[model samples]
Target: MREGSPGWARLALLALLGSILVPLVAAGLRSVLWALVGIAGLALAAVGVWWTLAHTGVVRAFGVALTVTAPVAVLALYATFGMLWPALLSLALWVLALTAARTASTRGRTASGQAVAEAPHAPWVLMNPRSGGGKVGRFHLVEKARAAGCRVVLLDGSQDVTELARRAVAEGADLLAVAGGDGTQALVAEVAAHHDLPFVVIPVGTRNHFALDLGLDRDDPTAALQALSDAVELRVDLGYAADRVFVNNASFGAYASVVADPAYRDAKAQTVLKALPGLLTDEDAPRLRLRAARTSAEGLQALLVSNNPYGRAVDAGHPGRRERLDSGQLGVVCVRVDNAAQAARLVRGPRSPGLIRLSAEEVVVEADTATLPVGIDGEHAALPTPVVCRSAPAALRVRVPRRRPGTRRRPGTSRASGAAADWPRVTRLALGPLLRQRHQARAGASGSDSGSGSGSGSGSER
Candidate 1:
């Protein structure tokens, strides 16, 4: 209708129909029962996996067995019933339908933005040479920035980035830009915001979450440099934990604890696997109490406070991405799954009691311990109890290329996150055009009748 894609909606509906019909057609009515069993088994497998991560000894071994067997059992049943192909095909179609539905729903949506007329006169850029496995050197970002008439400073991991930004500002730098990870981006962004200067982002980091949210091209770091010539300024919010700034998010409890381990940097997967059982089950583990506007959650095993709320569905392209950075609210996701039952309930999606998602202007996290370990933008820290995480609404002026891949504002195009699709919403959107047309026809008929009545009254008066 007014927005989204009708073509994609048709495709999504077709795929959805196929997802259901394929299994039924191939394996008859019994396939429905088999499908239900498969779903239950998957849910059980999820619970089992959670158990293995959160328990030790016999319980952990049993969880491992359950995790391995549940999915295998489902497959075995499908194979024995000669419904394996149909089941797999149905699952694939369902996934495709969901993806198409998301695209259809989000299509044609564009973000409101402000255009910049003039470029910065004296823009200063900071590049971390080692970031993204030396992306700066690999792309020759330093030389390219200088070529674009920017004063460049290459970070050697020795100097304070905040001080560098401050020095640049003191020396009459008009704009601040960074070609590094989110942690470094936060450091410079704070300085830029303090000075009320425009900040630029070059997505040369291992994971440029901020850049992606801003609709910048993460694959082409050099494309961001074009902003110096033609730019659009977006006033976005920044996340803060106490006095520290975080462009992405501040993590507490399980994730923070994992990052705090000295061995994490060397062997991340091994470290997380080794530490999960203790962190998830230990009674002595730091329990966090989180308070936000109109809501409070206690005894959270892990909590993430982001600059803006992340979409419920994970984006196949960019996992854990926020739909908008300018929401002026902190996104809070609290997890407290303590048992297999609670873990199994996760199949209910966002409605599960074990998982909580909300948004607030501010959040306060309190812990029994005097200091709590935190992971701010993937960097570990220890913050005092009663840590305050707040959103600074429209605090940073982010300069981005006017023409970027992720921000093309056109019909059948959108800046919205292609995360998980909401099926109900998608269904409504698919029917929107017909609904609008019917309403319009009724309104027009009513208007005509009113007009005729008015004309008759005028003639009678005359």
Candidate 2:
């Protein structure tokens, strides 16, 4: 069926209803009870996993055992009761329904942008050969950029990037661009913003989160080169943590501590897993208090402040992705899972008190300690407390290719802010056309009756 059509909407609504009802109809009331039990078990298992990270010795072993056995026990209960098939079917239908609902609601949505008439006369591009496993060398970006009438600077790890950007600006560079990670991107972007020059992004970074949000093709770094000839300028916001600018986000608490570890660069996952326990349990560790937009939160274990609010739909294939960069607001997510019960409650998603998600124009992060370890766009740094993170609305002008992959919203994607579905909005969208048609039919009938009565009266008078 065609997307955004009445039929598609009806199908989505039906699928959503069926995802809940099918289990009950097939397996009776026992299925409902079993499902609740399963959810609780899974929540407990999550708590157990946290325990395994935060504890050592016998308690850790118990946590490991519980984590392994809880889900298995739930499965065993389902198998014993002959409800496994129905449970699996319900889950599959739920996923399908979510996908259909998201598509029906968010179709035809696009980011706000304006056309750029003039191209930069003197563009300077920086290429980091080691950024994404030597993407510059593989793509031959330096040669391509120079051939396109732009001056190219290849970074060799010695010279500071910010200084390089300033030097380029002094030498009459009209546009500044980077072919590196978000940290490097932020540096050049800041320089470009300071000089009021257009900034371009080449998605040569391993995970170009900034480029992805701008709708640039991450797979093809060369595609970004088209911005020089044919482009649109997007006035996007930049995030600042104190004086430092971040293109993506500033992370504090547990995550920042992990990033500051010496072993993180060589072994990231292992480092995080090893560090989480100590960070979570250390009482003397600096407790953070966050204040923003008339709301305040304290005792936060982890906090993430982003340049723009990220899309909330976890299943939309783009978690931690921002739909628009021009919102002029910072996305703040604070986590404070203090105990097993709090960890278990996370199954409620956004409703859980353990997680606080909000948006504000500015945020102040104060800690009990004199200094706070922060991860700014994946780079680690130490900042003095009460660190201030604020949005620099329309501070940087970004020139992107007029035609790129991310410019259009893909089907099955959502712009929702969190994991929870906005069912009310979905319902309205799903039933809107049908409701309008019904109202029109009733109005037509009323008009026909009025006309008929008037005709009879005129006949009698004649």
Best by TM-score: 2
Q: 1-462, model 1: which lDDT tens digit per residue? A: 235677777778889999999988997888779878987998999888897898778887889999999999999988997989998999899888877876766632223467899989999999999999988888889989999999999899899999999999999999999999999999999999999999999999998988877778888899999999998887888999999999989999999999999999999988988899888878787788999988998889999998887766234566546666777889888988887888888877788898888889999999999999999999999999899999998899988888888766432123444444667777777778888999999999999999999999999999
Kindly give the stretch of ten consecutive residues in candidate 2 with the minimal lDDT sum: 411-420
User: Clash pairs of candidate 2?
Assistant: 312-416, 312-417, 312-418
Task: Kindly give the number of clashing pairs for every candidate.
Answer: 0, 3
The global Cα lDDT (0 to 1) of model 2 is 0.84
**What TM-score does each of the candidates earn?**
0.89, 0.92
Candidate 2 scores a C-alpha RMSD against the true structure in Å of 3.0
lDDT of 2 by residue, 4-29 (tens): 44454566778878878988897777
Q: Which stretches of candidate 1 lie over 4 Å from their true place?
A: 26-29, 57-62, 107-111, 313-317, 408-424, 438-462
Clashes of 1: 0
How big is the positional error of residue 98 in model 1, measured in Å on the Cα after superposition?
Answer: 2.2
Report lDDT (CA) for all predictions.
0.85, 0.84
Local lDDT at 321 for model 1:
69
Of the candidates shown, which would achieve the greatest lDDT relative to the real structure?
A: 1
